[model samples]
Each structure stands twice: as C-alpha cells, then as structure tokens.
Target: MPTFTTRKNKIVLTDYNYRRDIENRLFMAELSILEVDVLQEIINGSLKTTLTTLADNLEIAPSKLRPILDKLAKSGLFQIQGDGVLVDKEMRKYYEAHIIKFDDDFRPDMEYLQGLLSKAPIHALPSWYAIPRSSDNIFNSIIEKFLFTPKIYERYLQDLVFDNPIISSIAKQVFAAPDYKISASALIEKFGLTREQFEEYMLFLEFSLVCCLRYVKTNDVWEEVVTPFHEWHEFLLFVQNTHPVAIQDVTPITAVYEKEFGFLNELNAFVKKLLKKGVSFTNAPKDLLEVALLLEIAKQEKQKIVASVYTEDWLKKTRADQAIILYRQSLNRLIANEQFTSFSEKDLREVEKSLKNFAHGKWVYFEDYIKGCLAAVGSVLPTSLVNRGKRWKYSTPNYNEDEREFIKLITCEYLMQAGMVATGYHQDKLCLCLTPFGRLSLG
Candidate 1:
C-alpha cells in the first residue's frame, strides 16, 4: 500500500505498490529503461558479479548503476549493503515476469476497441468511444496512450488533465492515497477552488467514469463525496500493463475538453427532450447554451476556428456596435447556409431589428441558430460556474446590455478550451472550428 504524508513542506513517498489485482498487490513501480536493464543484470545472476564487474558487462560506469539500484531499492525491490546489491529471494521470480510490463513494447490492441464497440448498444456508443484512441483507425495506437497511463504525454490535450488542470489536480490528489479517500473541504480550500467550481469539476469527473460516489461524515451528517473509481483504476492498470510502453513523447500540457466526456452523455439526453419543446438559446438552460457551440463546431467538421473580428474587442464596444459584429457573423453564416437568397446592406436594415436583442446578449437566439449544427446528442440543463454569491443561487450571465458581449466573449473562449472549438490565429484571423472528436460527434 502506498502512503503519502507532508513532511517539512515535501510530500513523502512510502510503500509504492501497484495494486492492479488488489490481492496480488504487485510491486510494480514505474522504472526507466536503464533501471530495467540494471534490474535484469541483478536478476539474471548468471555469474558472480560485483558492481564493477556488472558495470563492465553492461558497458556503463559503476557510479551510474548505483542510482538505478537506489531507485529500485527505494521502490521496495532490493537493498544495497557493503557495495554489493542484494535482491530479495521472492523478487527473483516476480521481477523477471514484471520486467516486461515496463518495457517499450506496450501498445493498446486495435482489437480492444473493436471488441468494446461491438459490445456497446447504439444508444450507449458514446460511453464506449466518444474519444478516439489515435488519429488513424487502422491501428489502435491512439487508444493505447489515451487510456490511463500517460495522457499528459499525448500531442493533443484531449484528456481530462489538459482540459481542466484544476480538476485533474484534484483527481491526482484523490488517487494519491492508500485508498481513494480525501477530505472534501480541505481539497477545495487547498486549491482555492470555490465550492461551485469544485462541484462542476466533480460532475466532469463523474462523466469521465473516473470517480464514483461514497459517503463521509460532514458536520454531523453523512454526505455523498467523490472518490477514485476503484473499478476503473484496476481496469485502466490492466489495460496499460497488457500494452505497456516505456515512455511517451514529450507533449506540452495545455487545457482541453474537461466537460466534453460528460457533455456527450448529457447532450444525448437533452436532444431527446429538447425536440419536443421550443427552447431557443434565449430560453435555453445555461448548460445547454454553454455547450451550444459544440454542435456548431461539429457541423463545421473542424477542430479549431478563427473568430477574426468576433473577439473581446466586440465585448468592449457599445451595445449597438457589439450587435453589428455578432450579427454580421451570424448573417454571413446564415447566408452561406442558403438561409437567405442574397443578403446585403438593404437587408441588414430589416435584419437589425430582429437581431437587436440577440446582439444585446439574447444568447438563446444565437444558440437557436446553432441547433442545426448538433447531432441531437443529450445536454444537461444549463448551469453556471460563476460563484452565485448566495447558497444554491442562480444568476443569468447578462442582465444589462454592457454585460452581453462580456458573456459572449467568455463563452467563446470556453468553447475553445473545452475542445468544442479550437480558437487560433489563422492567416491573421480568429479561427473557430471543430476538432477531430468534434467532427466525430457529428457522425
């Protein structure tokens, strides 16, 4: 069992055991290639060897081998005494078999996905493979790394770690325990996350299938709390072990779709109910509107988008000016879609009256236009992450015209971060478009 305790401002590591099969509790510590080579030397024990002789056999300095031995020893594999590396008797058997699990040969089986998808119901397909394992379907290379071992290693930050750092950090802390248990308030306050934000992150985790609910006593009452999904830890470990890679490429960590995994499930439900009712973005719940652009990006079949003139600059403008920028983009897209035969300046005179409220932050109208972009997946009732300043309270984004563009700009940025749209500068314009999965969502 692994344990963690803070000692003099440093996290102390102890008893790091990989309990994939809780009963067996394999002492499977992550090791470097060199470390594995060193362990192999000791385990082979083919000839009587000292550090100097072993170093000669491996063609490396004895000094270099010392640290590798230390790391493995600290990881509970061996001990060093009187300049001789001592190995535990039982380890001779275990380490030899365990050695392959850490080698560079691990690859997620392409057939794993095929088997999983085949087992899934059409209604629950999103749950099985909403995110791709890799860019190419012929090989399951992408699915291999995207699993649990090394998400931070991937080029695209689609996994939870990059999508929402705070949430990912919380998940890490939750797992860094003998068992997946942690104090709730201490976690929130430790990271300076508002209660509402923590709750939002919890929902994101729940959707990812990384957490399940348990109860802990709080203020004399038992309360439901979030903890690591024990079942998943074992499964993820099994998946990675069977397809272990020594290390993944260095990928810069950035935020990506935190809510996206859950969004798919939620959107599926929302669409079923939404079609029966007349809910435009104006009256659409916050969660629905929050994810409104996801469908739009899906329709475009692009991962990123260039906002061009539709950026924060529009938010700082006067209400009428903000309307002009947003309304123009809407008009252009509508005209491109053949919604209008030939719109021009003369048409704007009449269109402006209808778009006046939309430009002034009648967000639902914008969402209504985006409806055609979605594949009718479910979405949850819209909600807010902004601290409402009261217990269980709700506040609309923009109650005044000046607040309209502010909300819109923020939404656009969020849509990009959530992988709904990847916003970037393309040819000196703000580009907005669908991502890979975003296009996949369309299918």
Candidate 2:
C-alpha cells in the first residue's frame, strides 16, 4: 500500500490496487510522450502550462503539440480549456497517493487478454510478405489460450492481405476491368499464397471493390466500360517512362503527377497524336478551361506539376489583359457621359491624365491618373472595403470575400505547383497540404 500527506494534514492510504489498475490500463493503451507528460503533470497538480509552453518544453512545434493535447482531451483524462488543462478529479486523486507496481509473476486480467487479442492482428502483419511464423504462432497461441472465436483468425488473415502492398496493387489493377471476375484459386497460384491467405486476400479485395464501385455509382459512371487490359498496358508504359535508374535519387514531378492522374501518360500521348493531326490552341478557350479545371482537380488530388511559374504567369497576364480591356471600355462609357461637362479644369485634367495612364499599359496608378478609372472601378467596390493605407505603411488590396477566397485557392495551388508547398483541394472550401511522404514522392 502507498500513502501521501494531504493539505488537511491527513494521511491518505490511496487505493494501491486502483492505482496499479489505472497505471496498467494506461500502459496497455498506446500513449505518446506528450500525453504521458500531460497526464502526470495534471496528477501532480502542477499543470500550469499552455499548449505553446508544453510544445517549447518538449522541443516540438506548436502544430504537432496541439494534436497530442487533442488526443488527451478526447481520452477524457484531461479537460482542455482556452487557458489551460485540467485533470479529472477522481483520476488525479488516485495517482496522488498511490504508486504502480509490476511484479515478475504478475499476469494480465481476462479483459486485458481480450484487448490484447483484438490488437494482435495489427501486430502480426509485417510490411514485407515474409511473416515470422514464430511471432505469428505466439499471437495465435494467445488467441487460442483465451479461446477466442475463429473470427480472430479471419481478422489476422484480412490484415495480412490489407498490409501487403503487392496484393493491394494487384487488386487495384483488377478493379479497372469492365466485368472482372478474379478467381481466388488463380490469385493463390499466381502469387504463391496459401488457400487461407488467398481467401483473406479475396475478402479484402471484395471490400475494396465495393468501395470503388460505390464511388463509380455515385458519380453515375457505373455503366461506363473500362478496359482493364488496355489500362494495365498503359500503366506499364507509364511505369517505364517514370522509372528512375537510381532509387536514391529523387523522382521527377512529371512522374509523380502521372502516377496520381492515372492514364495521364496515355492522355498526353494521345494529345501528341492529335497534335500530329494539326490540333491547335488558337480556337481552344474551352479546351484551355478544361485543362485548367483538370490542373485544379489534380492539385486537389495531390498531383504534381511539370510546368514553371512563367507559363502560368503568362496565362494569368492574358486573363488580366482581358479584364483590363473590360475596365477601359467601362471607363470610356463613364467619361463620355454628359455629367462630366460641369467638372472644373483640374478635375477634367485629372480625368484625362488617368485615361492616358491606363492607355500606356499601366494598371497601378490608373485611379490617380484618370477620373473615369475611379468612377468605373470604384462604382463596383463593396462598402465593406477596409482602407488600410492610412493606418499601415504598405498598400493592401481591398479584397472582398469572393476575391479573398479566390486568391487563397490560387495562391495555394500556385505554391504547390512551384514546389514551395504541397496542397490538395478540400471540395470548394480550402486546400490541404500534402504529408512529408507525399511531398517526398513528388521530389
């Protein structure tokens, strides 16, 4: 038994069994260092730290620290406030005056054994195909020791297929077939897998196929015929084109993009074929828009890019030029109005100067140079435009809600394409950055 002196001068023999049980429970559950530290601090009544402070103490970024705190909060061990963290009173009291003991002869309880069996499947599946049977046998023996159902064995097999990269690849290849029916026996024979393994693989593939089918159905493309054999050949061609001589060296952006947008290599090759047939961009705004949409979609889907910023800049410049032309036309209409005749010479001169400024292929100072420019452009400006020029030294765009969102999406996609960042679209709302692995794959 363990005890501690309270603030009331009372010797409290905190329940040793309860403390041991709780400690064991925590040990059994997967906990990160940050989580353990947070729980311990709270138990000791010394939790006087913010997320930022904890991050600094742990030598981790604040972004990474937040997720750990979120997990602790989710587990009901800690209550997270905008100011700080608070531990559950009952849990804190248990840890305050009792210590956990792990004796050599101590074995886990039946409930713990049941939990262990549940986690066994994830442990048994290795990254590689070759499973250490001795380890498998140990896990299988644990299942048998507890007299768990045959479903446990089935789960282990399912995990084995789920974890196997080769099997997953094969399943993806098979999924493209118009009316594909892959025999389990054929898979076993082809992959040198046992019958039990083959059945498990089939089960996993069935689940995956169902998911893919659901997506296809929802998109109203279920009836569309996909030639698996042709797609497979195309994939092989793509793989050949993208293959690197040295695995240590980085992969090209083109290769990464090609992998994400499947059959894109074939599509590009087909486009080149059309180019040989004299296809041109001269009468192709619709086509250009389609390509832009595809690029946007690819960015949303974590695709890579092969083009430079100069190319996109040129395109944007063309669009901006079109917008400028529209602006000039609107300015012309406003200037031609009979209402302008009553203006003073200085105002009229300012108006003329603004028009002259705009005519010279300049956009920045058009408002100061031409009164028409101010009338035409400013007429459309929203009332909510915040004028920050007086308060701040730098000139900022008075971007409305729509313009701000557009800028954010465009900037995110541009940064991703420029290799400065990795981003994916979140429907129509936001863009999420790629993971380190995703970024590395693009390199």
- What RMSD does each model have against the real structure? 22.5, 28.7
For residue 283, model 2's alpha carbon misses the true position, in angstroms, by 99
lDDT of 1 by residue, 1-443 (tens): 11212211111111122132121212232344566677777777743346777788889998897777676676444667757766677756655544543334422122222332332243343323343433454223323433323222222123333244676677677766444567656677889976556655554454343453334434644344455443334433433333212112212212233333333334334444443443444444455443434333111113322222223332344533322333335434334434333333343332222222222221122333222121111121122212223211111122233223322333344333333333333233332334443343222
> Scored by CA lDDT, what does every candidate get?
0.40, 0.34
- Compute each candidate's TM-score over C-alphas: 0.23, 0.18
lDDT of 1: 0.40
Worst 10 contiguous positions by lDDT, candidate 2: 209-218
lDDT of residue 320 for candidate 1: 34
Model 2 error, position 238 (Å): 65
Residue-level lDDT tens digits of model 2 in 112-221:
23332333244333211133545655433443421233233224333433345645555544443334423433445667876445444433332221111110121322
Q: Candidate 2 has which clashing residue pairs, if any?
A: 300-425, 353-369, 354-369, 354-370
